[model samples]
Target: MTGAPLLRVRDLNVRIPTPGGELHAVRGVNFDLNPGEVLGLVGESGSGKSVTLRALLRLHRPPIVMSGEVEYGGQNLLKMSEARLRSVRGSQISMIFQEPMSALNPVLTVGEQIGENLREHTALRGRAAQDRAAELLDLTGIPSPRARLADYPHQFSGGMRQRAMIAIALASEPRLLLADEPTTALDVTIQDQILRLLLRLRDELGMGLILVTHDLGVVAQTCDRVAVMYGGRLVETAGVHELFRAPKHAYTLGLLQSLPGAGAQRQPLQPIPGGPPNLRALPPGCPFAPRCAHVTDECRAAEPPLREVAPGRLSACIHFDELPALRTELQEVHA
Candidate 1:
């Protein structure tokens, strides 16, 4: 994290024209992704986790507009031409979408789909592509890899379909992988399997990954670092252990307090007050101010820039000192 990052995102913002008005899906987001690191983007629904990831690949259609520098190896992805961006997409970066059935081509055999990727990105062709496709499937732990390659998306179970999606995403040997809710729809057992597989693959391939998920448990198990988003803005970011041990944002603390306990008799969960703000008409100051118990008059007066609150950690809270206190307060609340 001290050296140059594998992927650097700065002041990234995404806006889309809606019937109501211009929707600000992402707002001035910034982060660094180190090589081979698993970074989790955690937030509830509509927090802009998926929107930020999709913007990286220019996948979202207009009337969507984006402004930011997404630098990978010194090139700005946002400035690239369509042809150049297309080439950069699957080769340098790939994404495993939340729903494999929606991402996968139902008409094509799984083998053919992966083969097409190999042919496009690498020199593999004909039998070579087919053979490599099977190997890729095997790498993702699909049983009878070659036999299953001939099957369509519909032929695979939910877990198997996700595995297939990962295989296809890995076909190009991308340097960075964006996984949007890769384990969301899977059972707990299968989710564990996929998380383990992703960790193994990241180590083996030495590829940086951005995992977008709302489940903090998944983040704790799968990520090297975690970034918490709220109302399209990053509220806190730190190493996984550091963030869990001492979060520096009220929003992050609220999320941890809401996680269900395993005990037979436990107190009611302390969920955050209110819901996410309307992006089209965000408040004049911090978007999370309404729901943040620690919010001050100053918080509603102006937005707080994401600043370094601790070594290698960032928070956008004016009263950051209150962050550490939330742990004990939440414990008493639940006790």
Candidate 2:
């Protein structure tokens, strides 16, 4: 973290024109990713976690305006030409989308898809590309990689298809990987396998990873640090251990309390009081004010800026100091 970050994002905002109106999807999001560090983007659905991820790559098409800086290695990705960005997309930065069935081309064989990346990014061709494709598949723990290459996506199981997605993403050996809920639609055992595989690949390949998920347990298990997003903004960000040990935001505490800890009693989970705010018409003040247990009149006046509440910790709560006291109460309730 001391050195220059591999990726630096600041004041990122995205707007889309919908039939209803303009939808503000992501607002003033800021974070940094160091070389080989894994940053977890945690939040419930519609919190803009996925929107921020896609914006980093300029994946959102036009009429959906995106502003602010996404600097990668001193270059701003947002300002880059489509041609230049394409060169960096798969070879330098890759993403494992949330779903494989729709993301993968059903008509193409698995090998063809993997080879496409190779053909575009590398000099490897023909037999060489095929061999490397097989190697990549094997690396992702898919059995009989050579044989599987001939199979279409429909032929592979769910887990195998996910692995194939990873294989294609890594075919170019990107320096940074953006995974949007990579473990979704997988069984517990398979989820564990995918998470382990991701961590292993990160360690072995020394890649910076951004994992987007709503599960705090997954964040606790895989992320080095976590950035909790709410209503299209980052509410809290801290080291995994520190965030879990001493959460400094009401929304973050709500998330942790919702999780059933080890050996917890058999009881109903404490769900958050209200649903997420509507992005189309966000509140004038803090979007989470309505649902926040510790909300005050001041909270409803204006949104608090994300500021350092502690060393190496950032929270967007005006009464961040009061959050620690609620931790005890939360523990007692869940106990």
* Candidate lDDT values, in order: 0.89, 0.91
User: What is the alpha-carbon lDDT of model 1 when measured against the actual structure?
Assistant: 0.89
Q: Residue 131 error for model 2, in Å? A: 0.7
Candidates in order: C-alpha RMSD to true structure: 2.9, 2.7
* Candidate 2 regions with alpha-carbon error over 4 angstroms: 264-267, 325-335
Error of 1 at 228 (Å): 1.1
Give per-residue CA lDDT, model 1, range 212-249, as digits (tens). Answer: 99988888788889999988989899998778777888
User: Each model's TM-score, in the order given?
Assistant: 0.95, 0.96
Global lDDT of model 2:
0.91
Candidate 1: regions farther than 4 A off: 263-265, 325-335
Model 2 collision count? 0
Summing lDDT over every window of 10 consecutive residues in candidate 1, give the lowest-scoring window.
326-335
lDDT of 2 at 70: 98
